[model samples]
Target: MRPVPLVLPLAGLPHRVPGDTDAVVVGGGVAGISAAVVLAERGVRVTMVEAADTLGGRLGAWPHTLPDGTRQIVEHGFHAFFRQYYTWRAILRRADPALGFLRPVVGYPVISRRWPDEDLTGLPAAPPLSLLALFVRSPSLGLRDITGADRSLALELLGYHRERSTPALDAMPAGKFLDRFGITERARSMLFEAFARSFFCDPDALSAAELVAMFHFYFLGNPEGLGFDAPDTDYLSCIWTPLADHLTRHGGRIRAGAAADTVEPADDHRWRVRVAGGAQVTARHLVLALDPAGLRGLAERSPGLRRVGPALAERAAGLRVAPPFAVSRLWLDRDVAPGRATFSAVTGEPTLDSVTCYHRLEEPSRRWAATTGGSVLELHSYACVEPDAAQATARMRDELAALWPETRDAVVRHQLCRYEATAPSFPPGAAGARPTVQTDARGVRVAGDFVELPWCAGLMERSAMSGILAANEVLAEEGAAAEPVHGVPQRGLLAGWTPMTRRRR
Candidate 1:
């Protein structure tokens, strides 16, 4: 399960691009910044224009003052930096070579009101063994559950091959696929259902192929196992600022608050991007790295893009945004009982999905807690059904209290609630509709988590991979060496093997 280097640095190539080579990356999240870093280091004059006032996109954080005049940096939500994310880790190395900001989070446990917490961390690192350990140790899934379930269907989870699995399960809903497995309700809810919501959609609306792919990517095929880490400080100080400094040191410029309004084909083999304030940037290479809806809007505005990259234009039109997600960070007057995991994935809840005791995870939160004798807790709902932020926050707080009784009486010192529909939705039959890093347009490329990728990756890793791939395409066009990209074992251990089919005898 160790990493396999898919793209290696080539020999006999110059380290930097020739003069006059420039790239305009249109989004400044992980994807856009990733591309910018690679391109800038290669002597490509890179200009990254981000729509928001701050970088990081969905992972972005900014300054906020609590009611007591205590300053804090808040984020869109919590993210787990899995060790298997080699590509993302490589990119992060540019900022902090040792990646010192990240600290290991102990014990990833899935909590529920119906059953005791099911720990998913520290299993064997490789599949078959890893899968076996989970089967042997997890109380939620046991012998009776397996015997009563469809054995052949359950085996498919271990034998995930992109060629076979994507074709076989892409058209089915994840909920339907899970139901067909015939596992016990406890196993389904605690293990599978809880994991599915992390993708920002209900299992019923997500593609079964995605569920299987994720199973392989995060658990079965992953060599690094399930353990993950988080930053010891806020993203602004640790991630964004350092990254921004790194990019600038290589002659790159990041223009925050410069939202792109329209993209038009320009003269002399260049693309012209019109910003909100009537300013425009024209560059020879254009990386359209934006959210699903942002890409669609820009594509719709650029009528001439159809002539250059009809497929990209069409795919942008078809791209679907996932349901709205809500994150509520509260400054509680008191802490929860001892031994609560830093992060807990909750299942079988109406609106709540996960909770993070920020005070236990980050340094800034810990300092705030020490100064005020209060804790900082964050609740997240990937696919929130609530109508607004306030309602969602209230519901999540109530759900958390139900799970941890001590939280019921804790006073909310200050709370920040955020709601947005920005994550991509992988609905059934959405396999290839997304655009890839290299588009039909001569010098235009796309990079985002939503962008289609040949190898298996998810979340932040996917964004980093697409961005690196996009930069590689630009490097290829410029006759420069491509940056190396590593990948996990593409197929599961039992990829070529199939269990007995329940079809005809």
Candidate 2:
């Protein structure tokens, strides 16, 4: 269950590059920050440009004035900091060496209206045992469901082969895969579908191969248990500001609020990132670490970029953005039931997928609640069908009231709703067409969750791993040693067991 070394340090290699090894990273998300941190620490002159005024992109947090004139930090969305995010935690260590800001979420529950809640916490980390534990303890699943299920599909789920499984199941939808796997409807709704919708994609629109990969990465092959932790404060204070200071401490320059307009070529340097204000950052290496839509737009804007990095531009063009998701943070005039879980993954609702009682989770939110005798609640719809923010917010609120019951009478003093299409989508038959860390482009690498990686990682970890891999590429070109990367167990537990079973028979 130990992490496998995907990238290892080499002998007879220098730790740092020459003093003038310069790089410019576009986008200030995990991907860009990771690349900038690694390069800057290794003596590269790193310049990071972010469109937003803050460092974290999707994970960004900013100050907001409540109706009572209370200043509070509002987050863009909620994210679970899983224990298995090796590279991301390494990068986070630059900000807080001890990572004291994180607090463990006690239980992982998928709550539904039709059946009772299914808790995914305390499951064994390794597969076979974990799989057996789920089958044994889960109220939604039973021995009858196992006996009635498709054995082949069940075996395939157990044996997730990166090289073969993806091509085999890439053409099928996740919904169809679950149906074929013969899991009961109760299990499908409370457990499988709840997990599927977290990618901001409907099960019918998501790829089955992607679903299997996620199952392996998050639950089956993970050495870390199902429990995860979250920041007790805000990202701006605990994560971004400190990490930004860490970057500048090592001679890295950050140009916040500077949007990269065009990526133009330079005769003296490898690339120049031209910002909105006519300021340009020229560097020997470039990491285009933007969201799918942002990267595609930049590629389209800079037609000449096709000449230097045709593959990067083409991959950007083909990358798909997931459906719009919504986050609605409500300042409730009353607190929910005291015994409610701090965070819960919700299912069986058309518009609501998850809800977090921020007052119970974070320090500032707790302070606000304690002073005002109110609660800070955040509702999310990962694959929201509604486009309008207000309408989506209303729907999620109504759904929350239906589930929680106590929220039916609570009045919302203030609410902030946001709907955007920022996450990547993995559609059926869309593998191998996406770009990886090392593009065919000269002196250029792309780092994002949308970009295909060779290893198994979920959302934030995927971004960080890609960023580190991109930095390693730059380090290789500069003749400096590459950073080591770790990954969860690559193959599934039952991968080679089929052959053994046949041989024994």
Candidate 3:
């Protein structure tokens, strides 16, 4: 089905007509695209340069197929879309109208050996009110168990919202918070191994403040109608189409495989970029939308950027990209009994993390089955160990054999692909320490998910927003009237409060 079209509200500012001005945009990820799109719309001639052959850096690598070439069983990496992602959904709707956004029939199930086998069945049909409601209401835990630390269960979950005001929560590990709540040993094990592996991959290692911030981002303010699930469409085709189409229609240029090797600040506050192919391009404005690590190559070109170099280097240093979390999607060789929109077999078995049937959606059962062919069963399990491609293959085969009794013989063709860095790790106040968009140099500016505000939760929407901000900074320097992009407006980042302004409606 085609996705619906949408009209994104451009942050309106005074329109200043430039005299044949050109801006160079670095990186081709969501952040870069977002900034490029906004600038193009503002009549800025943007030449977006990407080092990779593709636009999406890490994001493009995701939603890929396995050896046997199966389809994605879950939502896109980067970030799972919900109703709250107005900007993201607007782009998808504009791209194609038939893209159906369907919430999973079950709430995200937290599986553990201590829970009952059937406990993960279709999560209770409670309207998502808050993170606490979503968690406290799940069949996995009892109120008494969660509220044992405090007299009031409501206070226990939501009341501590203010504890983050102090530095202790930022310094505390998630284990400390869980212990204070008196969470069961089984629950803790399950959260760290099974549930977290599905996203964070190392919940125990993640900071309590970052976790609390995530809780706040999802459930704090926008408490109504917050259900979590996968989108019912192709990942890139849904969001990228509209943004790309808009840029193309506006005479904006996007050239891939043109990795920018160096960017030198030229006279008159303009910049010159030397790409890998010996191609040289000069622009009055420049946007550095590449990641902090990726831009390390440019340190020699822009000397003024040296001050922010350490901050950028520090972010790159701490990055432990989640080694693709183990998830195997099995396509049954033959048809089997089909029912419901999504059927998950969460038997609470440590090895058998979860099973999903692709034929459950309203799409033609025969056609959908044809997509997977030979019947389909998608299996998801936590990474038992660090994944080495060949070793993971062998280990997946062994795990499949142990979990699916019928799969030992009946299975014909199956594919395995790990969800690489499904979610990025942001320690407490890490978002606050994000590098400045504007460097000490007059011309160069930064944009990307790794920047302060949006990518904290590591979602596509955040990166998109960051891109818009990055572009705005460069455009503004050229005396062009662009809206200021909003970064997370809070104190305690590095030291003083630095505002991250991105285009907003």
* Clash count list over all predictions: 0, 0, 26
Off by over 4 Å in 2: 497-505
lDDT of 1 by residue, 230-253 (tens): 999998888999999999999998
lDDT of 1 at 288: 89
Spell out the clash pairs found in candidate 1: none
| lDDT value, candidate 3, whole model | 0.52
**Candidate 3 TM-score versus the reference:** 0.73
Question: Could you tell me which 10 consecutive residues in candidate 3 have the lowest summed lDDT?
Answer: 496-505
- The lDDT ranking, best first, is 1, 2, 3
Index of the highest-lDDT prediction: 1
Candidate 3, residue 298: Cα displacement in angstroms equals 5.4
Overlapping backbone residue pairs in candidate 2 total 0
**lDDT string, candidate 3, 289-321, tens digits:** 776556544664554445434454444344434
Tens-place lDDT per residue, model 2, 1-505, is 8888899978888999955679999999999999999999999999999999888989999999988899999989889999999899999999999999999998988987788888899998888899899999998888887667778777777888787678778999999989887888888898899999998999999999999999988988889978899999988899999999999999999999999999878887478788998988888899999999999999888866777789888888998899999999999999999878889999999999999999998888999999989999999999999878999999998888888999999999999999999999999989998888887768889998898999879999999999999999999988899999988898898875543234435
User: If both were scored by lDDT, which would come out higher, candidate 1 or candidate 2?
Assistant: 1
TM-score of each: 0.98, 0.98, 0.73
